[model samples]
Target: MDASFVIHGPSIKPGTEIELISNTDVAPTAAQLLSVEMKNVDGRVLTKVMM
Candidate 1:
């Protein structure tokens, strides 16, 4: 399966393209954007997507 998307916003880094990422990372990334820190998260934040 191939999943793709486009994220465009002030917070998203321009022309960012991460070749490796986990489905589990979605929640952590969202939490970070909401300024909420999760404890012992199963996945890490996709910081490469951020500016």
Candidate 2:
């Protein structure tokens, strides 16, 4: 499968790009954005995109 992610908003920097990410990361990233913690996960939040 081909996977790509894009984010656009005031909190996100313009023209940011991520080379790769796993499917499991999507949920964790969303949780981070909501300021919620995720437990018992095999993946982690992709903080690079937020910067």
Candidate 3:
């Protein structure tokens, strides 16, 4: 069986769900949310979840 995952934070809206996300995308997503730029990341940011 596969494990389910969640990304929770104060800026994130409750009950939001996104599919087909890569584990490698987490870092880039966080960086973008914090107004930090990332270079040469393995995966792209999950922009759909952004406000």
Best by lDDT: 1
Badly placed stretches (over 4 Å) of model 2 are none
For model 2, residues 1-51, the per-residue Cα lDDT tens digits are 886688766656688788788888889888888888899998788777785
In candidate 3, which residue pairs clash?
A: none
TM-score, structure 2 vs. true: 0.79
* Candidate lDDT (C-alpha), each: 0.82, 0.80, 0.79
Clash counts for all predictions: 0, 0, 0
Candidate 1 residue lDDT tens string, 7-42? 667889998888767777888988888899899978
lDDT of 3 at 10: 71
Q: For model 1, what is the alpha-carbon lDDT of residue 26?
A: 83
- Inter-residue clash pairs, candidate 2: none
By lDDT, the candidates rank as 1, 2, 3
> TM-scores across all candidates?
0.78, 0.79, 0.70
Least well predicted 10-residue stretch by lDDT in candidate 3: 1-10
Supply the global lDDT for candidate 1. 0.82
